[model samples]
Target: MSVTSTLGNALSGLTAASKAASVVSSNIANATTEGYGVRQVQTTSVSLNGQGSGVQVVSVSRNVNEGVLADRRAADAAYAQAATLASFYGSVEGAIGLPGDEGSLSSEFSQFEAALVEAGSRPDSDARLANVVRAAESLAGTLNDLSADIQSERLEAEKEIARQVDNLNTSLAQIQDLNGDIRLQIAAGNDPLGLMDQRQVLIDQIATIVPVSVVDRDFGQVALITESGGVLLDGTAAEISFRDVGLITPDMTVASGGLYQVEINGSPVDSTSPNNPLKGGSLDALFEIRDELAVSAQGDVDAVARDLIERFQNSAIDPTLSAGEPGLFTDAGALVDPANEVGLAGRIELNARVDPAKGGEVWRVRTGLGATSPGDPGAGGIILALSDALSEPKVVASGSFSSIPRTAAALASDLLSTIGAARQASENEVSYTAAKWETLRSLELEGGVDTDAELQKLLMIETAYAANARVIQTVDEMLDLLLRI
Candidate 1:
């Protein structure tokens, strides 16, 4: 080959080697970077008259397994959903308290029952009556606190949903911007791998908030769609919106037309409905907790309160109570109507007529609320009847409990067990989904940059660079010899 042609081939080889080395160095540098895809320089062979000339750098392309990436994103979303559910359940369990804890509703109910038995044994003792009243108050306060906590959590979840919606919009906009930049860069024959990596990172971030599917477009552009087949972005991002309801209460429910709804691109989406587009992500889980799980828990507490109110309201249990009049237990010092069963737990209170601290007489325990005169001070009849009323098996109206007759204490225990079971189930799901997500993430990393492979490639690039330099040196020496001749 002519020295000129030889020099040209050597220079082309040198340029290709330099570009390959750059790609290898970049791969090593970003080995640990999150969402970074490994890159390789594409090369094409040059030919002259059907003979090999040299090699030319075509383009730099990122190495990414789209299928694995898609699976990882899906796993991320599922894990986020499970984690959200588990977190909410844990909060509820904390608020409900464990069976043996002092503040637990079950424990307080047991204390009240014990106090009633003691008072029943010594009906004449004002101290025992006072203790019974205190225990009843404690039980009522515990239920009230739990109900409030459930509602508070619902409100917080609503607010969090609003915040997440805003974050989702921002992420979508950023991704769209990057998509435009990448298309422009590709059209200009420039490397767009860096922009593509940044875009992938944004996509992963948004996946945790809501499950999404990615579609590849021409010129390095991508479109995003939700798992439910709702288009989130194509050429531009769609608007996501949510209505925030401040200071939620038990009465505020979707069925009652009190709660706010989620909107996507100006279309109302029922967050609680099965067809929700935002399913399988943290946002969906939060909505479920706020509108469904928390509401059901509050209903359970209200049912317990209704059971208590109804049990004591029976004149057979407390003859002093007139028909329709409240007995020892009242709803905020008033008779609880069966129609107003909601929020009963938050309103449950001890009858003031039997509570001396509330300006009533302790002797009222022995006498009926309707009795103008105090009955026999030593009359253990009413105390025994009250104790029996609490311990006797009775059918509860609350659907949360079995319709079969059970004592008040047994029903409370069952309710606690139910809550505990739900929390346990959620925790188990969290563990399972978290493991799955971690495994997928590990697989994705394994499919990413391999430092050892990159090092080997770097050595190859160095050898090629040295050989090309040798060819150039030989060509230069040959040219010098020709000049000397």
Candidate 2:
């Protein structure tokens, strides 16, 4: 070989070795960085007339397991969905209090029942009658507070959905911009690895909000489509929008103008529908909480209030209460109209006639709302009858509970049990999905950067660099010898 050819070969080897070392250094530097893909220096041999000419650095290719990455993204979406649901249910459980807690609905009902029994035994004691009124008020207040808490949760979920929509839009726009940059880099034969990595990070962020499927396009460009078949981005980023309500009430619902549906590019869509493209992520879970789970909880509480009103409105329960007259438990101090059962829990209150604190006579507890004057102070008949009305098993008109007959206290326990069961189910789901997500994430990290391998590669690069430097030195000595000749 000619000396010039040898010099050229040595120079090409040095350049390739330096590029390879730079790639190794980059890999080691970003070993712990999230969303960083490992890069390798791609090299090819050059030849002239069947003889080795030199080496060429072709491209800096990113090492990634596409299938494993897709699996991890899917797991992230599922985990977010489960976790959001569990959190909302946990909040509801906290608001309702534990089954036997003093401030809980079940506990309040038990206290009321116990007070009624005590009042029945001491019918002449005005203080005991006063305790009965207090217990009744506590029970109503517990239900009202719980109803308000549920509505508050709905409002929070609505606000979160709006925030998520904004985040999703931003991510989609950034991804689209990255797509343009990456495509340009690829077409210009420039290393687009950095842009591609940034795009992957944005895609992962989008996955946490909504499940998506990625499709590769020409020139390193990618198209994003939701698992639910909604196109998020093709040539341009799709717009996501939501109309957040200022306040949420128990009577307001998605179908009843209490909430708003998500929109895609000016088209409205139901986030909870089975066909929703945004399913399997935190955004979808929030929508289900605001529009479905929370709404159902409100309905159940309203049913309980309706049952209480209907039970006391019975002529057999309180003979002195004329038809249509407010009973001991009334809807905000008015007779309950069965037609309007919604928001009943928030409006439930003790009849003013039996609530001394509400400017009514306490003797009305025994004499009844329609009674003109107080009945015999010593008469235990009316007090005993009231106790019987609360203790006796009766069929509830509300469809929220089972059709079987149950005492008022038993029904309250059932309501608590229902809430507990729902929360437990959500907790189980969260545990399972979280484990799956972590496992997938660990696998992805394992497939990312191997520091040991990178070190080994660096050692090889050092050897090549040393050999190339030695060749260049030998060539320089040969040139010096020729000059002396």
Tens digit per residue, CA lDDT, model 2, 1-485: 99989999999999999999999999999998778999988899999999999999988889888888888899888888888888888888887777778798878888888888888887778898999999999999988998999999999998899899999999999999999999888888888998888899999999989989999998889999989899999989999999998899887887887578988999998776789988888998998998889988888888888877777777776788776787789898888887888789999999888877777877777776677788788777777777888888888777478888988888877777888888899889888988988888888898899999999999999999999999999999999999999
Regions of model 1 farther than 4 Å from truth: 371-375
Task: Sum up the clashes in candidate 1.
Answer: 0
TM-score of each: 0.97, 0.97
Please provide, for model 1 over 1-485, each residue's C-alpha lDDT reduced to its tens digit, 9 standing for 90 to 100.
77777888999999999999989999999999988998989999999988778899998889898988899899888888888888887887888777788788888988998998998888888899889888988988888898899899899899999999999999999999999999999999888999999999999999999999999999999999988888899999999988788788888987888887788889988886677888889989988999889888888889888888777877887677776688988999888877888888999998888777777877777776666776787888877888888888988886577788989888888787888898889889889888888888888899899999999999999999999999999988988999999
C-alpha-based local distance difference test score of model 1: 0.87
Lowest summed lDDT across 10 adjacent residues in model 1 is found at 366-375
